[model samples]
Target: MKIPEARGPVSAGLLDLLSGQPGADPAALANLHELVTVQLRAAGDIIEDEDFQLALFCLYELHYGGLEDVDDHWEWNPGLLGIRQLIEAPFEECLRSAALGCTTETRLPPEGTLSSDDVAAILFGLAAQESGPSMSRYVAKKATLEQLREFLIHKSIYQLKEADPHTWAIPRLTGRAKAALVEIQADEYGGGRPDRMHSALFARTMRGLGLEDHFGAYVDSVPAISLAAVNMMSLFGLNRRLRGAIAGHLAIYEMTSSRPNQLYGQGFRRHGFGAEVTGYFDEHVEADAVHEQIAGRDLAGGLVEAEPGLLGDVIFGATAVLAIDGRLSSLIMDAWDNSRSSLRAAVPAGL
Candidate 1:
């Protein structure tokens, strides 16, 4: 991935420091940390803060495909990790706080008595609750060609590398939970067929719409809320302690995906797009219907049954996704409702 344009002082400093060899300038690292501390203190909502979100996004990217022309060693630089934690701590707290409003302890069964089937029922209920604005409904019923393209741009950030973040939990899990995640992920990776891989399918959709298909191609085009959505996945997946959260995240994601994807395919088809342009959504419409069952019943539910103690984090993960994604949908729909671009800057239309 190319080094994204800096969104603020922290991102700018991060990019600048990453341009050099790791540990080459200790003073620069120190200054960067100090900058993060000061900015974090001054910031209101870290999740929606452009500078912090972009900075954290870039930092997490190093663990994935990495930044272009940046030092690979910086991926584990202690100072950089410290800076990421500075942002992550508050951001995660905010997510937990928001999730509180979306979930309740009464939703889950008593600690040691919760069965896998019972946990699955609770997760399905959480996924079923009607929340804020609905992006899928708008895309299906009213989005124009330009709005459709902008929607693809926002999704491109994570869809281009679909199933990766949650894959981190494979080693952290065992028995039924482990097998379930692998099963779901196998289908996500097209069951070993590279062309049919979800990311590859999504790339085809992007090209059909005359947009860039590469990962991170549109990182600069989205807003903080967009980045926060993906960042939340990375946060849960990367931390071993949050393994339950990642499981819950995947469960909710699968549970919620099928119907919207059906509507998404409908929207694209309504615009006269062909299979190549709508296949990604069509694929999800079918795949997630099955995936939702396995994820909710075997993956998340199985995990909670095995650990029991992680029940709270499991619910936290599921609700956090709804909270963040609800805000993202509202942001997009509100912009479109007002006749504006949902992206940070409008893209060229007439593709």
Candidate 2:
């Protein structure tokens, strides 16, 4: 991915640091750290703060496909790692607070033990609750071709790399849980068929509408909350300690995905697009229906049953999905409701 245009001073400084030698330059890192501290302190809402979110997104990007022209050595640079840690601490706390507000009633048995079924039931209940402002309904019933294109751009940040984040937890898991995750991810990765990988499928969807399918091509066009959504996945998946959170994240993700995807496919078809453009959403409608069961029962539930103490983290992970995604959906719908593009900038007119 090309290095994104800096969102503010921190991203600008981080991009500058990456452009140079990848080393512990105390003065440079310290200056960047000071900028980060000040920015974070001044941020009214870190989740929607462009500077912090963009900086964090760039930091996590190093661990993924990496930025264009950035040295591979920076992936493990101590100074960069410290900067990432500084941002992650507050970002995580913000997520936890938001998630707790949503899942206050979710609890485990008094014995501090639960079967896989019990855990799945709790997650299903969370999924069943009605969150306000449905993006799927808007896409299905009313989105213009341009709004749909804007929708894809917001999604491109994460969908183009679909399933990679949760895959991080596979090695961190064991037994039924590991098997379940691998099972679901196998489907996501197209079961060894590269062309059929979910990312590739999403790319196909983008091309059908004449949008750039390259990962992160639309990073600059999306708002901070859009980037924050993807960063949350990386934050949970990369840390072994957050294995439970990642598991629950995937579970809720799969649980909530099927219906919206169905509606998304409908929206595209309503715009007169054929399977080439709609296949990605059509595929998710069925795949996630099955995946939801496996993820809720075997992946998240199995893990919590095996390690009882992780129940809170598991629930937290599931609810965090709701909190972040809810905010993102509302942001998009709010913009659209008022006759505007959801993206920071409008995408080109599509084919």
Candidate 3:
């Protein structure tokens, strides 16, 4: 992806800065920050605010794949980092507040330290809760061809680069946590066979649907909550301060992945897709089922036992995903139920 269509004044200005020479203009940066500040003050439901979420999404994108026209030097530019912190503050506060409001088992052990098994059990219990409508069951039974395509488009924003956001936590971990993460990541990366990589499998799924398979292909079409869900991962992963939260995020992610993916594959088969099309989801069913065990017991549990302080953050990470993803599923299901598109607008496939 080249720089996408700017969603607002802030994004336009920020894109201009990134596309320009490194250290090009301080005045322009100041103006972008000013626009962002003004927008944040009046921005209702920041999670649903297109401009705010888009601007923040672009800010995080710098750390991932810098825009095609963007100079790499901008990734480390202090002004940009400062602007990143500006939006991140509120986004994080919103997430933390939402996590606090979630009803689930996040209780810590009485001894103030989790055993390898203790941490796993807490995460498992959290994953097993029914917090919202089941998008998986809906896809398994009722989704149309167009609706399935729409679902893929929404997911393409992240699935095309699956496992990357969480990979940021590898170096931040040590001992069993570190080893366990590497074990999980190896499978996600296809364990030495590129075709088997989760991202590659997902891309094949997109191609099976006759949709674009490149990263950021349908980003402009997805809604704010979609962006917000992925942004939450980047937020937890990129911040060293939130290392525990990132670990927790991955545990919940794996624990919840298998069944939904199975249903997703079933939905595609309902449309007459073969193994090539459903491979990605089918692969996850087995992979995540096994991963949930290692992640819960060894990765998450070991981390808490090694560093007791992260237990709260670990649970926060798990519940935060539950809360955020529940909202995202609700957004998709409600739109589909009403015969409306979940995207910000109707975008033709393969755009």
Candidate 4:
């Protein structure tokens, strides 16, 4: 959880400021903004830009659980927030574009033309119809021990804090939507048993794999595409205006979760691991089946019914999850196919 090595000038400057180094300069904020803006414009694929994505990840981290040993004051620093906005503008645009592309081929019912139940039905139907490359399928059928470990490393970025990003929506919603979210979140939190929490279950999975179980332990080893996947959730969750998007993100996340989790459990069993090693996925298989219904109907659908304007954002958010996740899956599969590690080069021990 120590400050990660800077990936570029913006991250370097931000780190320096956080570390309380005398060399840190406020002027770097403007430089960082210009650098990110120019890079975002010139880049053909922003999601794959390690430096830009990592820098933005660091910026967003300040608002989450801040980096270990970094000053809390940096969270509210005007200069840093200003620079973050510069990075986020294009990132948001890219998300919208990706979402649009994913859903354009589908025939959606006209906006406001459907009841909450109908909207939920449409979302569930669309999720059911989706036919993308299944990372879980590959893991279940063909992954080696090393490959499974690598998969855990990649997943830890989000799983270690599972459901946290979506928690930000609690204050932004009301009535049935709010109640639905709380119900789902309660289960994610293990229903009053701290040890049963999904995050805790994932930690056990990491330990079972002989991997580090601490939060952020693998951050230094993951690539930007991996980080981007989690960062997108944080982005949607943290913005009040993006509440619908976050809800949709969670709905799609649950709807698509059950089957893959089953595959994941099968994969672990294929490797001779017992329930202890497969508990996280095993839990999700059953939990998400029910959660998908609540999320699609009561949560996402109710939210849009309460506020019709958020319908587009809801669809946009759900689609973004699929889009980014597709990219991450493709990256991992490509690397494994080529006999390369999908992670960044591992950090040396005791660094």
Q: Check candidate 3 and list the clashing pairs.
A: none
- In candidate 2, what are the lDDT values of residues 233-307, reduced to their tens digit? 999999999999999999999999999999999999999999999989989998999999999999998998899
Writing each residue's lDDT as its tens digit, candidate 3 over 196-279 gives 999999999999989988898888889888999889999999998899999999999999999999999999999999999999
lDDT of 4: 0.84
At residue 206, candidate 3 shows an lDDT of 90
Residue 14 in model 3: lDDT: 78
TM-score of 2: 0.97
- lDDT tens digits, residue span 315-340, model 1: 99999998999999999989999999
Inter-residue clash pairs, candidate 4: none
Instruction: List candidate 3 segments past 4 Å from native.
Output: 105-107, 348-351
The 0-to-1 C-alpha lDDT of every candidate, in the order given, reads: 0.91, 0.90, 0.87, 0.84
Lowest-sum lDDT 10-residue window in model 3: 100-109
**Which pairs clash in model 1?**
none
List RMSD in Å for every model shown: 1.4, 1.5, 1.4, 2.3
lDDT per residue, candidate 4, 1-351, as tens digits? 568888876677667667773225656656666776676677766677777788878877877777888777778787777777777777788888877656634466677765688768767765765535689999999998889989999999899989999999999999999999999999999999999999999999988988888778888799888888887888898889999999999999999999999999999899999989999999999999999999999999999888888888888888888888888888889888888888887733532
- Model number with the top TM-score: 1
